[model samples]
Target chain A: GAGVSQTPSNKVTEKGKYVELRCDPISGHTALYWYRQSLGQGPEFLIYFQGTGAADDSGLPNDRFFAVRPEGSVSTLKIQRTERGDSAVYLCASSPDRVNEQFFGPGTRLTVL
Target chain B: AQSVTQLDSHVSVSEGTPVLLRCNYSSSYSPSLFWYVQHPNKGLQLLLKYTSAATLVKGINGFEAEFKKSETSFHLTKPSAHMSDAAEYFCVVRLERGGNQFYFGTGTSLTVIP
Candidate 1:
């Protein structure tokens, strides 16, 4: 079975640019989540969606970060005016439902230079 | 507030020896705990999770964790260490404080020696 997957395993962009990272959750999964991992640290939650609507977006650091999942299976994490602090491995995860363990993706490493 | 702490930043164990990784948590609500492992340059994999079920939870790769609400601890353990077990371990706690979110620890790097 296919696991959660993120595209462009690696992305390098300049500061003050805009970027979008995509995630394809496992088929039939209604729960999708996004997280960010910095060097020598664990992943921090970013956003989560159940079905077509976002169930939670509190983890998003600021207004510059936004995500949407209109179809409930594919989600995108968008960053505007990227900063050096935005450089991190963006991880996506999905589960059968809420309150269950989640499976993760290979993640997209974004580097700002 | 909800938070998790990996007491040790790193743990070195000889192959075939016992492995123990300590974790403690604090949450205003009843928290759901999880253990995830990440190999170098790889994505995080679920090792085990402790929800509102049995306190002792067993997971893949012969790993298990016991949740103790009294102490607010969920320590992961394996009877014997394997060379492939070398990786970074993260303790996570989930809560619905206002909205659903997961809090992760700094992570504990496990080094298995032969």
Candidate 2:
């Protein structure tokens, strides 16, 4: 079975531009999560989805960052007016249940210039 | 607040030698602890997890970790180090009451010299 996957393995964009990163969770996974890994640091929680609705989004840095998981399978992390500070590896993960271990994706490296 | 702390930023060992990666966690409630390995340009792979079951947990590639409530630690260990084990390792903690958000440690880079 195919594991979780992220599209556009690498993306370089100018600052202040809008960027969207997509994630495809494993089949039958009901809980999805998004994380950002800065250079030399660990991944920080971004947002989480249970089914089609976001159950927790407190990890989102600011209002410019938003995510949606329509249909409960595919998710997209949208960054408006991207900043250079936003440059990092965007990782997505999914689990069968909320308390289970999550399987992670290869991640999309977004670089804001 | 639930958080993890990896004691070392980097560790190097010779092949066939023992490997140890230390991690300590802080949480208000009984937490779920996990160890994940990340190779270059690859996704994070689960090494093992401790969910209040048996204290000694074994995982893939001959890796294991012991959850110690007394020490507040869940350190990863292996009897023999393999060259293929070189990578970044992360320790994670998740509280039972929270909304399934995982708190991660900075990470420890392991290097195996053949």
Candidate 3:
């Protein structure tokens, strides 16, 4: 079975540029989540989607960060005017339901210069 | 608000020795607790979870955690450490009322010495 996967294992972009990271959750999993992990830190929640709607997005750091899951299986995280502080590993995870255990995907490491 | 606290930032142990990683959680209700491990350059893997089932929960890789409601703690432990057990471990908590929001601890780096 294919596990949750994220494209562009690594990405480097200049500050003030825009970047998009994609995530494909596990088959049949209805809950998708995004988290950011800085060096020596645990993953911090960013956003979560249940089915086609965003169930919660309070963890998004600022207005520049946004995410969408239009089709309910794939998700995209968009960042505008990227800052060097945004350099970190962006992890995606999915679960069968809201209270179920989540399975994580290999994160996309974004390096903003 | 729900939160988790990992007492140790780093713990070192030799092979065949007992391993203990302390974690304490604070929640307004009976929370769902979990332990996750991440190797270098790999995604986080769920070690185990406790969701109002038994006080003692067993997870993969011979790991286990005991949920103490009175103490508000869910600490991970292993009888004997292995070199492969060296990784970053995180304690997570999920609130009962929140919108399935999971909170993570700072993480503890386990270093296994042979």
Per prediction, the TM-score for chain B is 0.97, 0.96, 0.97
Question: Each model's DockQ?
Answer: 0.86, 0.92, 0.91
DockQ of 3: 0.91
lDDT value, residue A106 of candidate 2: 97
RMSD of 3: 0.8
Kindly report which residue stretches of model 1 are placed more than 4 angstroms away from their true locations once superposed. none
Count of steric clashes across candidates, in order: 0, 0, 0
- Model 2 is docked with a DockQ of 0.92
* Candidate scoring better on DockQ of 1 and 3: 3
Model 1 interface CAPRI class: high
Q: Candidate 1: TM-score?
A: 0.97
A1-113 per-residue lDDT for model 3 (tens digits): 99999989999999999999999999999999999999999999999999999999999999999999999999999999999999999999999999889999999999999
The ten-residue window of minimal lDDT in model 1 chain B covers: B94-103
How would the docking of model 3 be graded? high
RMSD of each: 1.1, 0.9, 0.8
Worst 10 residues of 3 chain A by lDDT: A39-48
